[model samples]
Target: MTEPILPRIRPAIAALAPYRQGKQAGPDAFKLSSNENPFDPLPSVAEALQHTTPINRYPDATAGRLRARLGERYGVDADQVHVAAGSVSILHQLILATASVGDEVIYAWRSFEAYPSLPLVAGATGVQVPLTAESRHDLEAMADAVTERTRAIILCTPNNPTGPIITSDEFATFVARVPGDVLIILDEAYAEFVTAPDAVNGLTGRLHEKHPNVVVLRTFSKAYGLAGLRVGYAIGNVAVLNAARATGIPLSVTSAAENAAIASLDAEPELLERVAVIVERRTRLVEGLRAQGWDVPDSQANFVWLPTAERTDEIAAAFGENDLVVRAFPGDGIRISVGEEGSIDRVLEVAAGVR
Candidate 1:
């Protein structure tokens, strides 16, 4: 049979590479590539997924109950909360809603991998300002780069992969500089994992009141151990969130995810204890790497960064050989998630050898 000819496709999308998740591991290995919660789902969360979801029927298309629940948690009106499959989904929806061909979306470089591609998918241009020497966002540089064509800006606090967070003061100053018309997405995906005293916690600070243009994104995928379930939300002003909701695919969030997330919230006290454990582990991992003469950043998230520079690929392969699965960014560095307790000793041992 002859190969069928393809129909017309957008030049930008056709050339775009798909999002790549972290590397998986074999049974004998622990997958430390994805910055996932090391703990299993709590009893309540599992029970909700098993019993609360009725698979034979479609879920609530609007997820009204979940929206109200999250709104209460963040002290916002129901219309101000937008629930989607994940925070990343809301990101795509917002980019599509606000930016389009000939416009620009700005974010920090060496940030969440999704930042670069999400803009292209929306047919918008991306402007990436490099991080500071200490591996934190150069917010001033990002603000300076914005133009009249800029429609959206995404800020990942406890910035993924590298792991430093944007402090509350830094955030306030940055917001003041940005144009009111530009949509600012403050991705707090790793907020629960942060242990820093001054780091930005959007919900606690009531960001919505002061910055109507900014939206805070949170996910049940990280600290809640709901990664496989796929549930997340955005809290922002009514008009901005409504615009994002309009662009989203209907009912992409299943009843299973919504119920599980609600259950997770019900079990917040227990879940936060587990987060404390991960934070402690992260502290140990950072100290261990730094002690081994490696240039590791102070991470407020569940992962530690190894700024391997030219040896990124080589070092990543070495870890793989030892059954320690980690994420590598070619020439940049490696991001090793703080995983099983048993994995810690091995990680330190591997680092000692590399040093």
Candidate 2:
């Protein structure tokens, strides 16, 4: 007989529904579900992986070498870089390090689905600021929602589902208005794909210089095409990053992942060329969708978003029936990744018929 397994765990832990990843974007399936890079890892990255020694040994617990390389690339100190299994792990660590029971965590709803859940996992309260009518984050409303208990806030720029970005000036103003101690996470997973002149590259400039409380999260998953390798890092003030590091699980990042990330940085020129293609494809996808009478928003990321929740299921089913899987959020909208040349055409055709 099973002794009450349900009652033995922490209520917060018991209440969590496990995180769900996007559907597999298989080659045969015209997959556009996850917003993964359409290209493969760089040749240098592949070469580095072949020489990765003894998988039997534990990975560098501090991710020291990777941190140094990242520091060099971003112009931040090695002490400020904290590598994790992926940006998702870094995001989770940020929440767990700051928020605790009854404290509030704020972010835009429908931005990153994990944003609200991460706080809940830490036994913290969540505040979801509603998006504007245009499906962009209402930064002013988020600012208004803050209180003494609000410990952290997440800002996913060129935001995940909406694909719209808050300009550098707007972000600067927003950051200025927030309390100094509140941890602000600028998750820039798609930063490499952005072409907007005003778009803030958090690590490359002013945000890092001016805001001590702000941390930028980046990944090799999107533009660098290293999603399967699971390497990412956070850039911030050394003290805050140190705190996050102290709270993070040691040796969670693999040596293979570290090696791949370092190689990706070294191979930036080629990677950026691939990124340019994705940007062009994104423009094509958006314009094509709009020409077909779809209400798509201005996107700065690797994906485009539909504006109405009502059309989400229909659009998804249309693609799925044609062996194209896409991410759909109920009462939110549909999100389709801009994939290879032919895949976008499939998405457009299915989208054209969704009605």
Candidate 3:
């Protein structure tokens, strides 16, 4: 018999590994593998849930009211906002809308794992630019890598594996080099957790004003404590937003998710207060790790990156032994999310033992 054929599957899918989201391993485990908010959803969000009774019906297909609220909050019109199940959903849609077979999607290696996977799923080639030893994106190198075959670029600031962000000036210079037609998806999944004064706030108003190709992706998954809700949105020119929206899966956003996100927005001030605390503790974690002989990079996100080329497995094992489950990429070092202060201290203790 001949082999069964599934034409819809891209050839690249065979080689691509699926994204592995962090999960709770044991009942007593301090699971800091995923970068999620340590706190629960805000009281305002709970109240919104109480008042929301629309679960029996389908949510507003366009998410009009939430889009309007996002517009008012971000200084853009509702047309410029594209909401989806989560930022990853927005990213997947962006790749689907822009790329085709043989096209290239460029991003920093050791950044977000999803960046590489999205391109392959779009039937496009993935171009992974390696991050520097210091764990920052080499924007100049990335800009030079763009060719006529390139369709899009995914720039993750406060980048995933390594947590530093691209500065505003650096982004401006980088954007100038890329051709105007190439789509740029700036993933700011950890924007709310970033304390750097110069952090590029994801091409929202500024980048959109200058370049029609730029789109900023954000989510309520991290700082808002709504990872379970799976809500994210993109801010860009209306045409680009519409193009991305066109590729979305059917009825992706639920009424509960929409209500939760809107509630998150209403409680932004209180949420920001928690962000401030995490920032302070993140600094302490970095300093303590560095002091203990760990080659930890300065992180802008709510996580710490340890640069271990060979000892990645051993370090991850040690953490697991201590009931602290950190995330481990193949060649990259371990990434531990900044949970509660005590949880971070436990990770530091595990690090101390590893050192």
Candidate 4:
């Protein structure tokens, strides 16, 4: 007998692959596949979670308190701050809000894995400008690629998988060349870990004030150790944020997450000291990798990029055999998060052999 027909699906979505998360490590292994903070929730954050109330009621759709707190921290008005379940959720909302079937979204390649997929899911064409040989965004090439069809552009500073940051001067120059009408999303997911003096600080630098189309996306997932809570926010012009809010899923940011985020802010100094520890560990790991004769990038984030090139799979396998799980891109390289201190020696040991 003939099989029954199935419901129709969008051709673009039908051909698209879902986002792939980093591989989980076994109980005996160190999980460095995801760029996660190597610390536990602050005591204050934990205490805040204990006080969550009204389980039967829905969360504040506007995330008012959290927005006000973040706005104060960033020196922006509360209406300019938009909180979502995670910065990634804000990304989806922004893409859906600004882009459409015939429009285009541009970003650097070998950057965030999610960048390409977001546009496809939104029915917009994705334009990828390749990174420079140094594994940094080729901003000039990116500027050249923008056309009238371009609806949005994403700039991932202290870029994922590869850790170099976009300097303020470079970013300023790039922004000047782009058309003012296109929406620019600056993904600063790892901002708190940045120690580079010249690196672009979207919030403090007041980039949004200069470029009204620009939106800065940040998260508590990295430095604040709130990955599981999924708390992140966007600082932008009020109108742009409202558009993103329109596209967002209602009440996605739970009250518990908001409370924990507020508490994390309250304990920022203590949590930042934890960040300093991770930064130190990252420096040690990078130095060790360099001593092993590896051409590791000068990462400003809490991770290092090993340009293993054709040897990516083999090196990744070597790391896995040592019970150190890392994120590997088949033809590119591996991105190892600076995790537990104990994991570093093993990482260096494995790197020695790979080199």
Candidate 5:
């Protein structure tokens, strides 16, 4: 058979791999790969999802109610809030709005998997600054790297996989060093789970007021247990958020997601109780892992990072064989989410052997 010629494809897009999710565990295995809420949905969330809104019609393109609620909570106008299917979607939208070919998007290395991926989608090159030995953002180096071509900068606090958060002081210093014209994205997807006293609080401090170019991205997926529903929001200057909206697919935020997000907000107290449980589990996991002679990073988020060095793949396979599936990054480390209380002991047991 003769080979057919393929249509022209962008060299960058052709070389890129699709976003890799955590491995799916078998039926009997406990999946600690994805950082997910272990508890069932709150009553309000379930009730909201049962809404009789006819799905035949398109949803409110702007997600008005949710935006209004978020605005009220954050002390911002509704116009200052932007809602999307997920925080990750908002990221791509913002990057598309701010960057283009020859521009650069800067972020910490081995941070959120999406950070390295988003810029390319916008036809912008990604500038990944290496994380410090403690697995934290080297904000000083990042600030020093800023140039005229730097269009967007993403700072993942309570950074995914590695587990350390950017502190308030660090954020202040970094922001001051960077040019005001460049867009700064604070990806706080796991913000709700953070317990450190001095960690940067985004919307609560009215960040956009202090820094117009800065935007904070948060999601209903983590603490609210609305992962599958895909609702996320960004708080920033109305004009900046409007730019992001211009680049986004309209009506992508469904009615179900909006309703569920609102319900999650209404049941915030109850939802936070579940978060508290996860935080306790994180404390146990960190302390337990260190006791086992494993040098685990202190995680404010619900997941813990286990640095297995050259043994990363082998240790991950060992975990899989024991029916405890985790996320492994080749030679780097493994990220184990705080799962059921029973799984805690199981994870520690597995780490004991692997260590």
Candidate 6:
């Protein structure tokens, strides 16, 4: 018997690899692969989640209340704030909204692993500019790379995996060179973890006001410890955000997630104290790694990058064998999130052995 033929698939999508999440650890291991908040859900968030009702009903497709609260915080109109399941979901929407066949989306390579694939899924070409030797974006090269076909550019600050923030001065100069029509997405998923004075503060810096084309993406998944609930928001021009909303799936942000996010905001002080603890731990870990002769990047985010290069697989395996799970990019580097305080010693020990 002959088998039935499969329907046609988009060639670009067929060739594209799905986004790979950070590795999970066993019960005995610390899950430092994903840059997640080490603390559990805030009591306020938990209490708020308990009160969620109307389970049979769809969520507010616009996530109005959350957007309003975010708008008040960011000094933007409610229309300028758009909430989605997560910042990543918003990324997909924004890419699809602005890019199309024959368009180009430019971003620094070895930045977000998901950046390259998102454009391909939208039938657009991805143009990756290489990161500098310090594991930071080469903004000059990126500016030179832009062409008439460039539709959007993604700048991930406190950049993922290799954690180094794009300085505010650098971003200002880069933004000036880009075409006014091009959309600039500042992905600041780990913004809350940054304590560096010079780092770009997208939320409060009023970048959107200065650069009408700029849109800032933020998430509760990291600092708020709401990763499982998937709540994030974007701040941008009303028109641009509306275009993103048009491309989004309806009712993707659940009521529970919205409530939890609001509660998290209400309890910001305590949540930020937890962030301070993580920042301290990150400093300790980085210092210990440097003492162990590792060339760790000066990360302002809640993680550090070790440029393991060809030894990435070997070092990652060594970490795994020592019951420490970390994200590894073969022939490149390793990203170890600042997790439980107890896990830091073990990480330093394993890293020391690798050297």
lDDT of 1: 0.91
Residues 123-234 of candidate 1 have per-residue lDDT tens digits of 8899999999999999999989999999999999898889999999999899999999999999999999988899988888888778899899999999999899888999
lDDT of 4 by residue, 1-355 (tens): 9999999999888988888899998999999999898788877889999888588999899999999988888788999999999999999999999999999999999999989989999999999999998899999999999999999999999999899999999999999999999999999999988999999989889999989999999999999999999989999999999999999999899999999999999999999899999999999999999998888888989899999989999999999999999999998999999999999999999999879
lDDT, candidate 2, residue 59? 85
Estimated TM-score for each candidate:
0.98, 0.96, 0.95, 0.98, 0.99, 0.98
Model 5 weakest lDDT span, ten residues long: 52-61
- Write one digit per residue (lDDT tens) for candidate 5, span 1-355: 9999999999889999999988887888988999988899977789999993698888898899999999999888999999999999999999999999999999998899988878998899999999999999999999988999999999998999888999998999989998999999999999999999999988776688999999999999988889898989999988999999999999999999999999989999999999999999999999999999998888989899998889999999999999998999998999999998989999999999988
RMSD over all Cα atoms, model 1: 1.1
In model 1, the clashing pairs are: none
Error (Å) of candidate 4 at residue 229 is 1.0
* Candidate 3 off by > 4 Å: 1-9, 203-205
**lDDT per residue (tens digit) for residues 83-139 in model 3:** 999999999999999998889999998888778788878888889898887899999
Model 6, which residues run further than 4 Å from truth? none
* lDDT for predicted candidate 4 compared with the true structure: 0.93
Selected candidate, larger lDDT, 2 vs 3: 3
- How far out, in Å, is residue 70 in model 2? 1.4
Per candidate, the number of residue pairs that clash is: 0, 0, 0, 0, 0, 0
Ranking by lDDT: 4, 6, 5, 1, 3, 2
Model 5's TM-score against the true structure: 0.99
